[model samples]
Target: MRVLVVEDDQFHASYLQDTLAEALPEVTEIFHASDGAEGEEEARQGGIEAVVMDLQMDRRNGIEAARTIWAERPQSRILFWSNYADEAYLRGIARIVPEDSAYGYVLKTASRDRLRLALRAVLVEGQIMVDREIHRLQKQGAAPRNRLDDSEFGVLLDLALGLPDKLIAERRGMSLRTVQNRLLSLYDKLGVTVDPEDEAVSLNKRVRALNRALVTRTINVETLEAAQRDLDAWLGGRG
Candidate 1:
């Protein structure tokens, strides 16, 4: 099998290549790309049976690169190795992946044996494997059929951006009351409660809710970044 290891860190990339070569004797060829752009270019060259992708990269993020690669070759298997199990990263992966394609999500901190296991699972056995920690967080942070639907998640993003309810409503084409109701639902889902009598608790409920969602891995940096990009585009169009 031919494998491509796409990682910015030279040491980690080398380690993965060496480990895979040693563990999988059938792996005839292994390629390396230091960044996501290079990875995309190499992927375009073809003959890549499986990819060990890093989630974050300097020039182009892994998600962006993976989206392009999968768009062209939906059959290519991929194993995501990253330090973060951020909901943003997971959501990004969940959104673009082709149906019926095998994939794995394993942390960089995973043991070498575990990494090898994930590689074999996705690359050889065509199985989906997610790190236990990340899988647990995914379940806890989601309600049945998605604890926070897209609309609620949108409201959470607006609140996380520190937008007023009116602005959020205007941006979402929702009434102020509807937006406020969504915010209340978000607070409930995120398990954030505010006490009107507690004068000593100085933090605003919205801020607290956002922070709690972040701390609990219900929301993450990439999610905020994506939301900010959308807002910027919206503002630019309005201008």
Candidate 2:
């Protein structure tokens, strides 16, 4: 099987290549791309049956690159190898993956045997493999009682970025009232909803909600950083 490894770190890339060569005899040929943009291009050129994608990369992130690759080739198997099991990364992957495609999410800290197992499961066996920690976060995030839909998550990102309701509405192309409503929904899901008659009313619901989210690990520094990048891009386009 021909495989492509997309990683920004040359050392890690070389190590992965060597490991695959030594361990997985099925991986006869391995290609390397240093960043997500190059990775997407390489995958698009065809002949790569599987990809070992790093979640974070310069120019483009793994989620964006994988989305494009899957758009062109829905059957392509991808095993996400990353140091982080951030909810943002998981959500991004969950949002774009083709329903019938096989995929895997294995952490960088995984044992060599586990990595080999994940690669075989995704590439050869056409099975899904998610790291245990990542799977726990996935289940927690998808729980019905506290689940945040896509729109709600978008607003939450804007809130975490300290964007006011008016600015959020402007950025999201919604009315101020709609933005406020979404905030209320976000607060509800985060379990930070405040009652007007209660002493908690003195606290800012937005701040409270963000704090709760951070404490629960629903959103982390990486998620906020990704949001900031998207916001910067949006602002750049406007200018």
Where model 2 places Cα greater than 4 Å from the true spot, the runs are: 136-151, 154-182, 191-239
lDDT of 2 by residue, 1-239 (tens): 88999999999899889878877788878999988889988987758889999988878878878888888889999999898767677777776789989998998888888887888888889998898866775676557767788888889989999888888998999999998899888788888865778864488878898898787767766567667877998989989
How well is each residue in 16-95 modelled by candidate 1, as lDDT tens digits? Answer: 99889978887899999998889888988958988999987887778877887898899999999899877767776776
What are the Cα lDDT values of the candidates? 0.84, 0.84
Q: How many residue pairs collide in each prediction?
A: 1, 0
Clashes of 1: 1
TM-score (all chains, Cα) for each model: 0.76, 0.72
Model 2 accuracy (lDDT, Cα): 0.84
